[model samples]
Target: MQLQVLNSPFSQEQAELLNRILPTLTDQQKLWLSGYLAASQFSGAQAAAPAASQNAGQAVSKDVTIIYGSQSGNSKGLANKAAKTLEGNGYLVTLSSMSDYKPNNLKKVQNLLIVVSTHGEGDPPDNAMTFHEFLHSKRAPKLEGLQFSVLALGDSSYEFFCQTGKQFDDRLEELGGTRLYPRFDCDVDFDEPAAEWLEGVLSSLKDAQGAGAAEAAAAASTLQTIESEYSRTNPFKAEVLDNINLNGRGSNKETHHLELSLEGSGLTFEPGDSLGVYPENDPALVEQLLNELKWSKEDQVTVKQGDVRTLQEALQSYYEITTLTKPLLEKIAPLSTNEGLKELVAQGNGEKLKEYINGRDILDLVRDFGPWGDSAQEFVSILRKIPVRLYSIASSLAANPDEVHLTIGAVRYEANGRERKGVASTYVAERLEPGDHVSVFVQQNENFKLPKNPETPIIMVGPGTGVAPFRSFIQEREETGAEGKSWLFFGDQHFVTDFLYQTEMQKWLKNGALTKLDVAFSRDTEEKVYVQHRMLEQSKELYKWLEEGAVVYICGDEKHMAHDVHNTFIKIIAKEGGLSREKAEEYLAEMQQQKRYQRDVY
Candidate 1:
């Protein structure tokens, strides 16, 4: 029997004894015994040969769940990395998006790790709406037996920064869940902090004495991913192949059509992905800051990254100087002797501080606060790292191999009696030349993707530069010879001057690639019709298309255009489906869940 059961390793009498002993051991004992055996094996492997052993420590794998709510893939990537790290450390991990998770099952989870990102104005990402609402609703279950942790990623510029993550953290605690690790709030430059937070959570879950080299090795693997070679922290240097001004002369907009070469970058992007550009500050602004601060251009300043460089170079490329935030004001207030600036950031001056920083910059702070005698290094120490600006990819890699494209709108305005320029936008517009290098990274947006099915119909409504991704979508569909009927509703100020990709639209239409083309130029008419108006104008046909399985997509401003479009959709549904507003909202929500409706609003 031993020879039959164990072909080569053991004799029959030994196998019989082992089987009898294994059956007598309890589940908990078996778990510990397994871990002890694994440790023994690891120890032996280390003695014989160190190269092949992973040294998985002595702890058994813990069951853990990780959920992510992502808008532009940051949260999702972080969650994936965390999951991979946890799994590599001998943890049984279950990873999922919030959209696919059932909220009612939260009570059953023993250990959970939530990684969520805050979208525009502190709203939850579209995939998280149902779970977010469910967690806050009365139907949420108590989780007294559950242990959880949260990693919140957000941009600090918004008033309600990391609102979704904060809500989750509070709600989980309120629902009786115990925190295994303290919640981590990460800013836009979140890579290092997030990694540190992951390590902390790992330390919390594992025994401090037993967790050895496995944690470090697993964590190192998490930093680099298999998806793409370039990340926000380590961007690719893509050469600017071409930069054309799309807006004609006399137009109020300064839209630039930038084509960059991604050759040999190992970066691949789909239609809905965005290209993040690390921009340089204007030389004029840098000069002004140096002059105002009375810092010598040659003065060396150590940036937050710990790299020492000239004050002028740091201002031009490292630290953020164009934008003003509440944190900056608070830091500057203590350094300055001005009472007004100090009062603005005082305990009871939240609203006043917000109001004052609306159209201000670093220069504004210096002018209003007065001369700070702090050294250049001291001043630079308090400043934040310059964040990358993401622009939707306007060209399909399938059509334009080895190249990526962007539609940039140069933002120039007058604020506080000084001409202010958008940091990234003006950098692309005025400073960047053909053959110049632009440090770029591809940010995948899975939420706003083209339909996988070739025969599915699509309706795209994009106003202004929002038309960028739609252009990629159309080009992709056309290049693929998709049999789907494609309709585009694009609007701007003028037909000729403000019309982005006009020639391409006409070419697509002439070649039968574009099934429908609708234009709404607000300045072209007296009535000021927009894309939502056009949707209402053609409501009957729009409803018919919806019934025929057409996917509706809206891109652009989230505050006004996306909101108006959403309301317009509800109204259309109510009128066509003959339902109440509540039912109409449900219908749209259902469509959203089914991926029939999507938005790429910024």
Candidate 2:
């Protein structure tokens, strides 16, 4: 229905503006607008009431503190967005990273909003470790008058999804703080849920402050039109310039060196940033799923409220089929009549459920639990959207303007009596070619960054694909002619077949952009040596470099390589500096707090 000036409170111009925007908005957008308008009306009504009718005890402070603990910058971005929204609504805002915030100041905060993402196996991100520990410690202060909320981001595929956020939310309430808004635990596709959480928080704040709080509806509407055209929500299609296999023939590993054109996209990135690629599922897997379901390829299904596509097209391009989550199994249980499937998802069967979910896909679920009663649309509704894959950029924007480079390792393995392939990795390695376009966006990482001072020496330890970002670092230093001395320790399986970017590292060392190069080829030696072994071998000089104010950067696998390398650093510090293990640990922690020790491990 069109907005008519005679029947509405809006002026002619306002009615025309509303008419233009209403038809273009999605269902979710319309619902949000309705809620916002209702909140505004309610606030206005409360303000018009007599001052004597107001409850003095319910009055709240206008000051707000937003703290974010981010690994790949998502939480930081959301925290900044929340701060802006609060500021637009006439609230005083103080925004900070969890690592930078002073713990003693917690008792002074009147309102607190935390945005944090859970890392591997439910651990807090590296930057959040200190604060997370402090808040849960015995010396933590009781926050009697504090009002707070939390926004937690995580992958549902993980067993302990959003664990860190949940911990903070419970801890705050235990310390006598009241919840201003309920905590939101978001899955991988968090954009919509996060928006809903922010809107709810704004409504609660407005209700507490009444109409005296400035209205942000007009400002938000204006800001939307000026947002960046390219983002996670709307990625730019970058044309591939080059695609080459970096590994020599006969190597066990396959790594692709890709160069993409960002000439007209206006996307800029630094050395430590990552590139997010949205990849399509394997057509073979999609066909197997279709055949098992006995569903027509041309059946129409709605991906979202307003977006519809063919079943085959949607399965191939939009939905995630490779991984299964506990929540997904629970959602699917009622749709099937299979007793075994239902029993496995029942309470007290968590171990069995976890075992079933590991290394299994949607195809396995359908085959195991036959005769699903739901329609194609209903089945698709329960599945999550395909998550983007992030790779460390391998080239500097300063050295190669309007071009971005990535080093992707193809992932293939045998599991459950069949071969499985990584969606994004294999897509780029086997299918992508020069002149093809891929949807991509740059992911800014504040937690991992090069030092602002060019004269400070840097020590880098990157094995396998972890060497990607260090390549960018060296290229950037070369382009800017920085005087800092840099050292690199890189490792792989075999020197002849698996040594990646060997010639490039040699070139940088020759030009003084890189001062030192150490390589460990595990398979080349009888006993198998890695980068950590090399660090231990050069313990004295490594400790000396640390004493010389050199920054250390590590990038690569988190579970094993990063963990082993971290312990190796402590051993080197203790043995060379003649300190105890405890003191060495403290020294490393201090380095982390000082931003001298940075990691981009996954």
Candidate 3:
């Protein structure tokens, strides 16, 4: 407020009166006033213009709206950053989550920017569903005067790369909205592309709407900018403090509980944020690939920045050889003459190509497709860098200052008669010892968070390692001594060997930190009973809690457990509330809009 008053060319009486009036305006009214100030200020800089701001109290400014559809919060962060940038440029900005936005009011928007992420397959993120549907519906208003752009964040490994983003861009254009900038699609490494896209948006908007740099900068600079010295691209190297297997011996699974020291690094994390770990590939796997290709281990190779390293070093620290994507296949196809490989990539067999890419490794691709190949350098050039893996943090900073913890399930399986290991999971499980350094950075997920109302009840459903964030949540709640009632439903294969954090959880339950607890050990029973079944058995009380306004959180496998649990909730609502399936679904959606239902499924 002080900056707004000081920056404007106003007399003492005028500024004093303005200050009293500004604080009472609603978000929409504030936006209208912001536009007015921007236009009035720019008009003052024009030599031919009179003292318009003095004559007319409110003039129009450049208008922009940033709406985000986020599942894990990457889109939301990017949206915030873009909003800050645009505001710095003197635009009247209104930022909102898609779930909270009013679709009917979109027609009033002059400059629209969407930063969204795709969830599973081709589906929109949970918060984006209704907004996505409304835009495609027959009732959507024509957007002839609107100028828009979209930034899509998605994983390239997925078949439907940026499906939600693509849909929004196409729909807006179909409604007669002019393209402010071309729709920008980004893969896992999105920082660079997103920055470039924001620049393009600002350039286009300023040119079309007449916002000068001087005035734009003054306005946008007033907004707070989020900054961190260490980030995804520039991670902090922290030493490991402890690494222990959570499961007992003879268990079929290997789950590691890792504790890392953040003593000297100023990194911090909240309960729901994720930790991104940059891991090196298994040396054994790299050696096997080198042996299979008959390439020289000592051969010099270059990575991204023309930085030179041995072929062995490059494979270990940089290139991804464990998994293969369709893009990699496309690059390798022309180099091979094998009819079988060629047929998979032939003009019309896209599905067959997808079938081949699934569950196949880079070693398998190289072995089956070639005889006479290029140098090691040529092969390495086509591969992509190994991206960092995100793990739900398991410790709260308030509970254990200067320390961060993670619960990782090491993945090991037999594929094509060879043992394959998960990169970061196994690296921490088998390789890292106490005092060893590991590169990591925190990725904040604002979408999945504890309710601000401490007295509000929360129900957590997490099976396997999905229970990670809940551990942090419990710790945070206990640290604050919050009055909220908390319930946890946990499951694994066996009760004896696989009940992770059992002692601590039991202690919490005894101390009244936990209101209720339920467990499911699938292998112990003759017939399988999962978490969803356990939830169904207690339908009456669950519905009672729902009626009492308790929030429900689900985390685990997206393909099965998440879906099954979701359907189970719909059934419970239908039976317990005596409503039809359709009404139950609608009820669930309404709860979602109210933020009573949230999930962190992978």
Go through the candidates in order and give each one's C-alpha lDDT. 0.86, 0.90, 0.86
* Backbone N/Cα/C clashes per model: 1, 0, 7
lDDT of 3 by residue, 1-602 (tens): 45255678897788888788877889999898788787658744751232243335433336899999998878988898888777555566899999999998889997899999999998899889989999999999999988899999888788888999999999999999989899999987787788778877776665454455554444444333445777776799989999999999899999999999988778988988899999999988887778887678999888867699999999999887788777667777787777888788888999988887777788788678763357878878888888789889999999999999999999999877788899889899889999899999988887678999989999999999999999998999999999899999999999999999999999999988888999999999999989998999999999999999999988889999999999999999999999999999999999988999988889
Per-residue lDDT tens digits of candidate 2, residues 1-602? 99999998999999999999999999999998887677656645554553335676444666899999999888987888788777655567999999999987999998999999999999999999999999999988999988999999999999999999999999999999999999999998887888778777776776666642235344333334334789887899999999999999999999999999998999999999999999999999999999988678899999988999999999999999999999999988998888998999999999999999999999888888863756888878889999999899999999999999999999999989889999999999988999999999999998778889999999999999999999999999999999998999999999999899999999998989999999999999889999999999899889999999999999999999999999999999999989999999999999999999999988
Off by over 4 Å in 3: 1-61, 209-226, 335-340, 371-375
Best candidate per lDDT, number?
2
RMSD of each: 6.9, 10.1, 5.4
- For residues 1-602, could you state the per-residue lDDT of candidate 1 as single tens digits? 12345466777888778877877788999998898679657644443432223266332236799999998889998998888777655567899899889888887788899999999998999989989999999999989988899999998778888899999999999999989889999888888888888888887766432445565546545656644567787899999999999999999899999999999998999999999999999999888877887778899987755588998999899888877888777777778788898889899889888988898888877877765647888888778889888898999999999999999999999988999999999999998999899999998888888888989899999999999999999999989999999999999999879989999999999998899999999998888989889988888888888888899888899999999989998999899889999999998998898878988888
Which residue pairs in model 1 clash with each other? 2-12
Ten-residue segment with the worst summed lDDT in candidate 1? 45-54
Error of 2 at 335 (Å): 1.1
Candidate 1, residue 474: Cα displacement in angstroms equals 0.8
Residue 540 shift from truth in candidate 3, angstroms = 1.1
Pitting candidate 1 against candidate 3, the one with the higher TM-score is: 1
- Given candidate 3, what's the lDDT at residue 363? 75
Off by over 4 Å in 1: 1-61, 208-228, 304-306, 371-373
**Candidate 3: 10-residue stretch with minimal lDDT:** 47-56
Query: What are the runs in model 2 whose C-alpha is more than 4 Å off?
Result: 1-59, 211-226
